[model samples]
Target: MDHTPLRIAIIGGGVSGLSLAYYLQKFGSEAARQIEITLFERKSSLGGNAETVWVDLGNRRLPGKPGTPYRRWADLGVNDVNLATSPHLRTLLAEIGELERLKPLENTASYFSRDGSVALTDDRELFRGASDPSHELSLADGGRLAVLIALLHRSAIDLVESRRITPRYTVDDFFDACAAAPAEMLSAAANALNVDIDWEDPALPERLERLRHTVYYPRISAMYFTDDRGPGGMPLQAPFEYYRLQEGGSPPDRRYFEHGVQHWLEALAAHITGPLKQGPRVEILRGIEVEARLSTQGVTLTERAPGERRWEADLLIMATHAEDALPLLTFGDGLSETQRELQHILGKVRYTRSFGVCHTSATRLPPNPNLWRTRNIEIRGREDTFHPYRIDYVVNRHQNDAETPCYDRAGLPQFFVSLVDDLNRIPRSEMLDRHASPPDAPASLAGAALGAAGYRDRLPAIESALEAKAWTLFKHNVLDAECLEAQAEIERYNQRTARRRYEGHRGVCPLLFAGGWTRGAGLQEQCLKQSAHLVALLLAAPERRLNPLRLAASGGQARQRHSQASGFAPLPASL
Candidate 1:
């Protein structure tokens, strides 16, 4: 047996890249020792979006006793994990030996209208009860809820059957089909889905192609069903029996770490490099950039630093965002026709940007304190379609501030993470010092206001500099879909070329793509699932070794047939 280590180079340290390394080391077994990994991350931090910041409450204590300023951690990006939709992530946590650290977070939410009126509120999660909470709903609100639920179920059912449905149909299209549905209800549901998908032109219904139903159904259905083979599990199979389970209510088991997600990332990296029964197999490099030169034989990775070091690998993993990964690959002469086409398909994937600002601001929430919930949707005005739904997440409440309860305690203000489409909507006082870059920075609304109000004088001695800043802005690469057909094409391309590379096809580079952007939008589960699949493929071919982990093969043939029926032509393999 050939006992040579399969050199693998990873280019991103985010969930996708980090998880891939973990799985390879965990599942590779005896063959694992025969695999060597070198991961490069440009950022000094490892977990890309899973960032946690420790905030000192100094004199601004919430629910705790007033002497010393309470110190607490805040998640600035990718906060909670829903076990129902994050089964893969759950498995990862278990493998890393941190499953016991999981804590439950309340995922309840209330939707508010432009005038601070309650449009809809669901407390199934908060109460943990089976009884419906709609008994007190007015006739009109009750009617709207009924219609919205029916529409979601109908879309899920049609998508599962995949018959008589347009492959390119979008959430907007599905909403428009129900013309009799009230406009206010439709708007409410759209905002509930997340945000105005059409960030550029919210006025145009035609441009609202945020995600195709083919993509959205599986995701939305997963959220509702939470189990295997639910409404969306087997779209082709009859799901009536599974659909009936909706009555039980798929309450999200929002999970988090008492410390932060960063702890998990560190634990995962440590476990991967920990005392392997055989020997050390993973090497992680931080604060470095890597560039790859692809060829039919293998991949050559070069460090983009002063030393100009280089290393050869059996395969290359571009486990970063599509935009960041594109420039890392040297695209000149060593590439094959298929390889170029793969890059083209990747380039077709699109991304949209949004901002998450963490601040101690109650102004972003509704005026009525009684309506404040774990997640509050503040609809400024329905007519203001360009940007709808300013989502203010009660960080303390959602993360269970009972230990440090921030609300109505000592008359102290609560901390919120408001998600906004436009950065300018946020007051300069509430944005992070580093993120207040010019061109995109919001107006200086509080320069004089803070000074006039003596905000600095109120800060504790140890917290003066940072506490003066009310917000820490986290810019997110929000996943938006222009055409998911590109994803289908890429999958087909990979399957068609998988065997060719194994057989030593002259111009094939053993390259695999994994990231939230590659499949749908940026979700933690998506990254884990994609990385797991790649690990399975890597351990199963060429060398013909088996790994303990197995990923269900994506039903590519069926999707291909649907793509053809929908008239999605394969992207030509041309320069």
Candidate 2:
């Protein structure tokens, strides 16, 4: 009933942080105005992983302005989206009403490494690690793999709902569970998804499950994780998609922003904060490091930028890696036992380094440019050998005639290559000399490696290129080993205290976690889900009452708010 505005602070300007801020400000009724939010991002620009850069791919200036320079845009960070699987993300896109921005491109049937040497498209060597005899990574099983993939997706969704929310439900857990499930369950999952079950073959479930582990998981990881390795990450494998064939949903479809994925972030920000001319009503502070002092009076954040000062808020939402957030907290007396323990658990999430290169000079593509004008290559490494190169995939951005119906022809632009390197095994310490030269120097090394592997016909015209984007990224957040342990610890602690939300020694923590890695099956969908889950928690709070009563009139708990966001229809009553 009290109408005093509630001030809140959000750390990290990533999708999780941005979406949380956006929804809190757009809480749909009178309460929306009563909330004031300030977002702080340490980065120089907004749109964390969705970064866009404008550079020349060697096109001439316009006729009118002969001397004027022209620049083409290239995505420096996360650019792919699966329209088939990410419902919650779709809801966000729908709310933004930018369906046109997400246009489909011709999906590549095969993936290869540089010069098409280690052709993952159909290479048996790709499945060198799979212990199972049947789960070979051949490209020909595409049709069967498609059906099995759908079942595996359903299994993850079903298992999460069926099993208790516990740390034991790792991706590995789901893999083995599906592989060992009762024939009836597997049969039904396949049949419901309209994938005809071979009634005579009782081993169908085991077959599908093996393929899921050997093929499906690794493929999905490629789309997100820089390199699927280390203790907590998915095993290194290729990117896979099969859910597209599931029942009546859209075909195997992946869509990217017609302009750039960055546009979505801009639009979301505009919707929440308003246009730039009027200034952001929802104040955003960039390139600022913040120190937090948390207590009942809300969060008092000290910003170190321009000048150092304190800004207080009623709540703090950490939408970044938990480790980045831990130092900011001013823990009094071991930060209190509960807070210390929380910090310890969060600190365990592991991360790895990733490197990439973007170049306008790459002249040659793989042999089948006729089949794939703009192909993406996922290099397959032998289980015994570690390829120190960061070459994850090579994408020709400018020549996507398959996916986009109508696009401008930027002269001789068919060679815009985007390359990724997740394995940071080759540290900068060893490559200082190459680094001293233009970034193109090290990038050229990638070409040589590909040619040596016997994938390319000839050397690229330009061997060197710009090291456009590189960062220390790991597999998705909470899914990793340390975070899972931490998550389990938090859940156990909550169970002992009989508290549903995060409440430490003094009242509740009032600090919620949101990100792709924080909740449910990790991905952009999880990012959206975590946002909705946090928003629902806020609404349910007696102090915050984030939104009106109708927020929970449908879903029984705050978690269901995620399902609620996957719009256009109500979830089943039982769900």
Candidate 3:
């Protein structure tokens, strides 16, 4: 007797969706043999943001095959995923036999968010002018740093739990409360950099406006919006977990894959898209634009490609960012309870505009070794209303296989620069150019952009460049106080729907959400946890669905697998 199998539709073929598909095949293959899953991706390939491309060095011929040229591989999106920071991914990588492939990354000890600093008298700040070189950095003692963490963690937990009885809470509210001391410390630091920031504005709004840049800069970098040296988010916050703070300074324990991040993603893809004897028959559709419509019974996905106009699914998972996901849900009515709930939650998110280009030019590579190992060369840009935004290099960020040809071919390190819109404020499409130099830099800065590196004379013209336009950086703004109220409303609605399941209520929205943005921080670490959350929801729902914290608390199957390798977390990266 064959029973009807559950049909699931996944939107966006990035890591989150792919991980979901992998887990479904892993856990559901036995119970739900006939489970059907379909994944749609707008890009020609899977692994959103995890693109592994190669550069051709003037037609370097391959061995035996003279006509064939060698192409050096580079990562466009995520570079590394630490098993310690994200243990869940370690589990997945092990399950798919990608664990041993992880190798420690080079030390990015010295970093340059701004090339040179200005001289300053105060030594208790984060910086002094780059010229001084004497007062580069000063940090609070171990006890004070500990206090900062304790205060931040306690306040956040207290505020979030308050939602059980009170109204709403947003990330913004928490930051507004916690940002004062940190902002003051940063102000002294930035002043040392010779950057003009009005830290002493009289009005509250004006003061906060100036302060937001200093506070959010690290948070944004943590999301991979710009180049970063270490985990750059607050503890127990949305962007990332708050631990790993350093009193003086700490080097990031990074590990790059021999094959690259796509190596992990493709493994998950193979589980679903490949032929497996005891696997769910998951179908992957690429290069398709999707529009999803929600209804009481189920959802309809309108795909634009291969002449497929409409398709139905019992469940829909939107793995896209908030902005891209909004227009797809068109019920045509004014609004339904469920439709409005999804809209309000998703609409609150904001994003910063930025772009990236991979090129063969050495001009963008930093002359500093600290910047060299980090693969980040911070460049100060022409002034704009937006404060603290910067452009930086990201090449060699994921390098582990020291293939000399990649360096010898061009006689320079391969470099990619991630420039924020705050540098010029021009539209990304308009800003892209064939020249390696930025269009908005001043005439004086143009030739000197390399900044005493002396490589300006040696670097080649931007022979070929690939532009990633308006890549989603980080949340432009934190969650607002009103989000708590809205989330509460969603819970109440879902509760009602669940109670009416016997009355054909379709089992409380019947939608599951998973993505880098959905939980933790917007990085590979968070994506792994978010994926596990969805898997837990699918297999062990009602008891605990989409609750990553619960997953973290319950030392279940993942924990068992983890014990076999390392204790508690993966071994600390060999510094």
Candidate 4:
């Protein structure tokens, strides 16, 4: 028997890349023992957007422990996970032995205007567009509740009936077909869904597919209604009660990491590369940016570090963001037609700069503490100047423990993470450690000075952390209209090429793309599912064909059952 191992190289240390490595090991069985994996990350840290910062509360102690340092951790990115909808993530947590660490939290939000008068707590109030305010405008004070609800019902009907319409159908098209959805409502929906565009503009409308994939459109539409079949294959009318459900469903079962998202990533990584891990030899290389070249021979990865190291692998997975992955691939007229097409499709994905600050700022929340929910969406200044994604997460509400240390006895020290589309909105005092800077601001790599330790090394000292909070800046990549179209094309291309490969035709490049960007919506679930599907394809037997639906359903539950039934028993003969 040939014991030669399959050499695999994965770029990007985010959920996509990590999950791919993990599944490969979990499913490869004894074949996994013959697989060698090299994971590369540009940042010194492993987790990409799953970053956490520890804050120090000077002189404050956790209830009884006075000797231990008083510190609490808060996620700077990827804070919440809807366990009900996230089977893949749930499986991962279980496999990595961290499933029990899931801390349930109430996922509620209060949307109000900057002047503190318009509090839209429920759908009726939201549709009304305002509560009681002197000059505040809620959701642009658009249509009455009855009118908006009618528009939604009509829009849902149109989407279901017109299922054959081009994927180019945009939110604008849906609104046009409905003819009664208020423009202000579109603006609000655009903001909530992170469209970041002038949604009302006839020239540029957010794609309906992108919005649907985002799955956060309950505020805007009953897209889920399009899924539930009624009698003769028509979409069932969604329950009117859906309006009460928060974006992505705010069930009592919603969970966040006990330590933070970074801890979860670390635990998964350890399970993948630790000594106890079975199968493949997994090596993680950090603080190294790699460029890839593909040929009939194999993949050659060249690092940007001082020595300019190089490595070889049979297959390369570009799990990095679309922006980061585009440049690494071989491009231009020199490439195959398929390669060129793939490059073009990948380049279509768009990204925008986003900023966030983790600070002890009560000012970022609603004026009335009573109005605070898990998430607070405040309209700063005025309606005309409203930012689409100015959300503040109350970290305290996410804590598993009922009581945590508070530095001051007068009032509990509240930790809030404010995500603003505009960096200028973050107060200067709150933007401590210079960890983040405005996009237009001259580039600062001060945080990068932490070397291989990454953000973990950049953590502020207890005293310093108490004085100046932690801030983070990351690329807010999105699968916009063009990106969604590109994804469809890419899927078609992959399917055709995979069929050809099954017939021993190596027509496409020896490369694969895995990331939330490759699919729809930059959510963790998208990343995990896409990566798992890619794994099934990469390791499938010659006669086997990829079934995304089957893989999605099986990967989580099958592996989970296998692990639980018998401790790390061999998987079934086939995935």
lDDT of 1 at 474: 33
Query: How do the predictions measure up, each by TM-score?
Result: 0.71, 0.67, 0.63, 0.70
TM-score for candidate 4, please give it: 0.70
Which ten residues in a row are the worst by lDDT in model 3? 566-575
**lDDT tens digits, residue span 155-272, model 3:** 3443333344232333444456545544443433233323343445444343333223332333334344322222222222333132221110122345676554555666666655
Q: Which has the greatest lDDT?
A: 4
lDDT scores in order: 0.52, 0.47, 0.46, 0.55
Clashing pairs in 4: 5-34
CA displacement after TM-score superposition, residue 448 of candidate 1 (Å) = 33
Model 4: per-residue Cα lDDT over 1-575, one tens digit each: 44677788999898888988887777665342277889998877666766666655434445666644345567777776656546677767877788897876544455555576555442221221223432222222332222233334333433433456544544445544434434543444333333343336442323332222222232222111221111112112222112211122212145787666766776777788889777767888877888888775568898876888999887788887777786786632334775767768877765654556777667777787666655676533322322244467777765633333332331446677776555456666664342332232212222331222223333344345333446665554443356667777767765665455435555345677787667645567767878767766666543144344355566544533332222111111000
- Report model 1's TM-score to 2 decimal places: 0.71
Model 1 bad stretches (over 4 Å): 1-3, 29-33, 60-66, 128-151, 157-167, 180-251, 276-280, 332-336, 380-385, 388-390, 403-412, 422-424, 428-483, 541-548, 551-575
Indicate whether candidate 2 or candidate 4 has the larger lDDT: 4
Error of 1 at 575 (Å): 44
The count of residue-pair clashes in candidate 4 stands at: 1
| Candidate 1 global CA lDDT score | 0.52
Pairs in steric clash, model 1:
58-69, 160-235, 296-508, 401-405
Lowest lDDT 10-mer window, candidate 2?
566-575
| TM-score, cand. 3 vs. native | 0.63
Could you tell which candidate, 2 or 3, scores higher by lDDT?
2
Model 2 C-alpha lDDT per residue in residues 6-72, reported as the tens digit of each score: 7778887778888888667656243433677899877545565555444443436556766433443
Model 3 residue 572 CA deviation (Å) reads: 12
